[model samples]
Target chain A: MSAENAAGTPPLLDVKNLSVRYPLRSGVVEAVRGVSFVLGRERLGIVGESGSGKSQTGRAILGLTPQPGIVAADRLRFDGIDLLSLPPREMRRLRGRRISMVMQDPKYSLNPVMTVGAQIVEACRVQKLAGGRAAKDRALDMLAAVKIDDPRRVFGLYPHELSGGMGQRAMIAMMLVGEPDLLIADEPTSALDVTIQLEVLKILDELVATRGMGLVFISHDLRLVASFCDRVLVMYGGRIVEEVAAARLGEAGHPYTRGLLGSAPRLSGSVHPLPVLERDPAWLA
Target chain B: MAVPTPPAAQHDRGLPAPPAGLKAWLTSPAPASRTQARLGRFYRGWRGFVRNPAAMAGFVIVLLLLVVAASADLIATHSPTVAGDLRTERLLPPGGEFWLGTDDQARDIWSRIVHGSRVTLVVVLLVSVISMPVGLAVGTVSGYAGGVVDAVLMRITDIFLAFPRLVLALAFVAALGPGIENAIIAIAITAWPPYARLARAEALQLRGADFIAAAKLQGASPLRIVAVHIVPMCMPSVIVRVTLDMAGVILIAAGLGFLGLGAQPPQPEWGAMVASGRRFLIDQWWVAAMPGAAIFIVSLGFNLLGDGLRDVLDPKAAER
Candidate 1:
């Protein structure tokens, strides 16, 4: 990472020993434990199964963990600002304009009634950027950037009118419209078909490279992560068990990582049953 | 139903397309597909509603009632309250200029019913204006915040709701003393809980949605999130509640008048007119029937409008 990009100090977002716990009516359950990472102006992928708290870690860093979910960290900094200490009012300013998120399913992520353009316009207008006409111009430009053929028409169409791929593209457009420095894409392409998945990933790649943006791509598919991301953080049982460059995934040292890799079926594999994961209690801690 | 059309399918259509320049793109609109070409999309939602048998009947009834109320001057020749000792026209049946006949006091029953509708509409609208905002505010905060705020506000609503609405309104009027304004206030206080409950449930569902979280991430203030995202989405349900509540308010206002807590005797109110007409019902049936029919028709109209609205405005329903 360039020193100038990192502001002559730590990474753009640095989370050291972050933990999240939920205090339900009955008892407290730890969701994330001792999860730590440093995000630079490049793609960092966190791969984990659903309950492993990869999503919680993302929310905690953004100071957006839903209420009753306790988040504590030794240090959580975004662009050198202490994230854990910012008031809600200040955190809000940092949220969409500086660090935006692309949620999993565009079906639920986008508001059903709002048109794609209006939702994007809302993201821009919330930052009080260019008023009516300029905002509309920027929204159309962003929609075009996402490869939407007819921005003018798509601008007036509601979420249900768009296909899953188009919705995700619109969501990406909305998130990027504010020109955020850091983008968190939580399984952005999982809901789409394989062809659309490639299209979406390509779009994200273009945005990240062209804008010099830092990306935290959260997903469960290790293959996708390894293929697209620069660095991969393999998480299990609410903790990041291993971190490796994408090129060194085959040479990964952790037993759990190896187990996950072995279990996934290869395209050229012979007619044999897929390998199953073997649990190790010590690996969880 | 077949291979689903991707959003890009229209790009390759062989028809002469607009040039991909600013003016051409701006001036030439996309060709409308079959669904878009249908004129159903352009009609006001109310026109769609009036096509339904029940809603159409309701619309006609409500419209007729409003017209009769507003144009009372043209419709009725005599004053409703004045009891000129018309010893001759007293208790007369439907005949001559007095179509609904005359009361024991020699007052015109048709004229009274016509004028009485104006009062009912006024009270219902006034009470609704007073209480809808209060209910919306309380319900939204309670539902969105949850926990202590929710529990405390809900308990208060429950306390109010526990009492029979009519009796509570009666008690409030008695405490505040008998008058139209006091009656409106009394009716408003009794009516807000249902709206609060409906709004709270709607807000609870809305609060969990991802766009709300998205709005938060977009730096939208709490008020903006509520106003722009949450409230507008909640409006269809809120509208249904308001329409439903209008009937209840009218009923309560009439009940208050029945107890002599509404418009004074000289002024025409359906309930007060009915109360006065009751003493002479055996001989003066027309006196009770006209105003009674007015109350029933107007209330039924609002109820039908509300139910029809609930079906038409729903986004899921609209898709079908």
Candidate 2:
């Protein structure tokens, strides 16, 4: 892939050693431990099972971890801007403008009372990208870009009025209207049907490529990641156990990655029992 | 190569024609005019209201009281404050001159009850208007801005809630001095704590909602998040609470008036009128009974309206 060949290009996001810890009465639980990865201006997928801290890793990048979640990193930078030490006011300016996140469930993520157009316009207005008629125009254009059949009609509809696929598309439209340089999509299509999922993926793939924006696609579906992304980072117990080119994912060296691949139910294979993932304490260490 | 068509009689044999009424009901078009659409909406709401007997009764009583309060000038046969000849009119039975009889002061009891609704309703409105915004702001700020801010605001709210509502209002009124305005201020001060508590609970629930997180990610300020996102979600329950609390506010204002701390005598305040008629309760029942009944009816109306509002506004109710 071109992303692999472009080795000399500087990474858009650089993380040396990042850790997220939550303190409890019992003890401090380390959700993410010494995780490090560099994201270039290409599609990079982070695949992991539930409790693997994949979502936390995405939230940590955007500084969206909830209260009592202590995020620590040796070096966390986005385009050489030190994210760790950036003031909240400056971080606010960078958040939706430079780096935007599309949450897991569009049903819960979009404001229920606000119209599709108003929400998109708010995203643009908050970033100072556009205002009033210009914002409305940009919002409509973004809606059309996301393949919404009737942008004008959909614009006035509330989130609950739209179906699951339409709501997800609206969310994407709202997030992308600001034209952020980097997008972190946390399980954006998990709540959708298979057919709708493919359509959403297509729109995302085209947008990422056309905008030349870096994408950190977080999900558990390995086959999808391999097909859609240029590179994949396999996370296990909050650590990056493997990193491989998406095309070369089948030949991954890590046992965990191999085990994940083996667990998938195949269409052509004989009816052998699926292998359960075996955990090793050393993986955590 | 010619295709054969099904006979028209064969097509008719396949299915029976639907009843005209059923067909009309199923295929009725949307309302043609804006006014028609509005009326349709109102009709649906009214139907839902009428389905609940208690709510309907409450609505009717509240509506009747509102009409009586609004049209006191037209309804009352005589001036509420003007006293008639004491020897001739005092303690007269319900008849020609005085419809509901006269007080010991020879003032028209019916006229006083009708005019007294104005004072009671004003108190209710003032208390609600004053308390709701104050409580909403307090609760939203406290709940949304959790941690030290939440801790401090909630502790203060707890202190206020610890005192019994009526006792607190009485104390405030006693300190602020007697009269309708002071009584309103007292009731407003006491009324807000419950709203704050309700709003705070709602805010806490909504503070962690995904939409709130999304707004934060969109670079919305704390104020904007609370105002635009948190407040609207919290308002439905708060409104229901306000409607319910209107009953209590009316009662409290009347209590203050009875104690001579609100709506001073000769002003036709319901509670003060009731107080004045106490001396002649046995001799002239209508004097106290008339205003007392008015108070009871108006309070009942507010309570029923509040209950109906809860049924209508609650999303959970629709689900059930």
Say which candidate scores most in DockQ. Answer: 2
Question: Which residue pairs show collisions in model 1?
Answer: none
TM-score of each: 0.88, 0.90
In Å, residue B22's CA in model 2 sits off its true spot by 14
Measure candidate 2: CA RMSD. 5.8
Global CA lDDT computed for model 1: 0.84
Query: What local lDDT does model 1 show for residue A123?
Result: 83
Look at candidate 2 and give me any clashing residue pairs: none
Q: What range of 10 consecutive residues in model 1 chain B has the weakest lDDT sum? A: B31-40
True contacts kept of 1: 0.74
* TM-score (chain A only) for the predictions, listed in order: 0.96, 0.96
- lDDT tens string, model 1, A1-285? 322353366678888899999999899988999998888888999998889899888888778889889999999999889988898889888988999999988998888878888998888889887779999999999999999999999999999989999999999998899999999988899999999999999999999999999999999999999999999999998999999999889999998899989888867847366577887999875
Against the true structure, whose lDDT is highest?
A: 2
Candidate 1: CAPRI quality band:
medium
